[model samples]
Target: MNITYNQFLISDDKSLLQLDAICGFLGRSYWADRWSRETIAKSIENSLCYGIYDGGKQIGFARVVTDYATMYWLCDVYVDETYRGTGIGKKLIESITSSDELGGLSGILGTKDAHGLYEQYGFVRIPDRFMRKFPG
Candidate 1:
């Protein structure tokens, strides 16, 4: 399977639409509702967003919030349900981690279920320094 991993710019409407589709497949309707089209447009424009396309259609999405020097928080990683288990996710993570923009930083993410996948890429659980803050 030849998948094209492309850098997504803010002006990419097709990529954004693909992202929306991927999110829906992942059961992330909350994201679909919470983020307006303008918000997604802005995110693509300013953030590090990547899309994996099969032929010409998007099948995976990943975003990175990075300082471009120190740390990168890998977030919103989702592969279309139909495309899961075929190494698209691995390729997406590899593509992002190998980029000069993120290669040297500490990559971090918290996954509810895909810890094993992340761990294979050298992401270990931080047993001692974990903390979170939620809406009160």
Candidate 2:
């Protein structure tokens, strides 16, 4: 799906992704600070990626890893520092949640500091119901 809001555009077009911009953002992000470009590219390859752009430049991104039936994990959500507070992130989330591809699926995400933001979108915290095993 492709959507435009104000000066920003959000699309699921993998061909439109700017790997350099994505790597630059995610590499410096608190969650994926140590992630390599190769890893990022691989993740994009395996997931449904949403790219938020300003005209021709990429400025924000989010991805969903899912089977499109049972479960989905929302991850690597970020907007350029200059673009925060503009509702781009919320729009991105709305786009993902409303998309036909993810309809009726159970959605989950892990955020150390964005609980309030997610809660606004109907995401509720269920204590101790989830677990993760990160690779070393």
Candidate 3:
């Protein structure tokens, strides 16, 4: 099946559904506990959301939180288990990186198992450069 990546439109019904479904399947960390259809829709309305479609069904998703001026944080990226190993993730990252809106900005993401994948897109771990503290 051919895959295509397109910008997510907030007002579109199908787009909203696809967004919620993707969040349901792949959202982790704080997102898994906090994201709702309404919240996801709002974020899509505000940020850069991309949906990956296989044939006609939505099968992957990614979004970048950026100022469009200096920095971009790529998040909420995932391919359906059935669609893994098929280059959808790479395409999504490529699409985001190549977009004019995200151009010339520092893009970053934190991944637990896909360092190799992100490396292909030029993402690297900044060892000891940053630290995190989760709220109790």
Candidate 4:
């Protein structure tokens, strides 16, 4: 599916994702900075991914790990630093949460900051039963 918000293009077409750009975004993120490109690639292959593009260059991305029936884990949400504060991230989340395939399921995401952004989409904080990242 594809959505146009202003001049940006948000789509779930994994084939349009740029590996280098994705790596670059996650590489700088506190959550996944240490992950290898191969690991990232593997993760993307197994999850449903969304990409945000400017004309043709990818500038934002998000991925969902779901069972289609029970629940979904939304992760690796990112927008280029250069494009921050331009509502791209919001649009990205909007596209993901409102998608027909994912809208009705239970969705959860972890964020160190930016709680307000996620909160707007009905993501309430569950501090007691949140998350953990064990080493492999």
Clashing pairs in 2: none
Q: Write the per-residue lDDT of candidate 1 for residues 1-136, one digit (tens) a residue.
A: 1235443222123334464564454455333446656666676667677767666567667777877889999877877777777777887777677676787888998776888888888899876697988656
Model 2 scores a TM of 0.96
Q: Per-residue lDDT tens digits of candidate 3, residues 58-126?
A: 766777788889999887777778777766677767767766777578988887778988888778888
Q: In terms of TM-score, how similar is model 4 to the real structure?
A: 0.96
| Model 4 weakest lDDT span, ten residues long | 127-136
RMSD of every prediction: 4.9, 0.9, 4.8, 1.0
Sliding window of 10 residues with minimal summed lDDT for model 1: 6-15
How close is every model to the real structure, measured as TM-score?
A: 0.74, 0.96, 0.75, 0.96
**On residues 4-73, what C-alpha lDDT tens digit does candidate 2 reach at each position?**
9889999999999999999998987899989888999999999999999998999999989999889899
Residue 29, candidate 1: alpha-carbon lDDT: 38
Query: After best superposition, candidate 3 residue 54: deviation in angstroms?
Result: 1.6
> By lDDT, who's the top model here?
4
**Model 2: lowest-lDDT 10 consecutive positions:** 97-106
Cand. 1 TM to true fold:
0.74
| Candidate 2 residue runs with Cα over 4 Å from true position | none
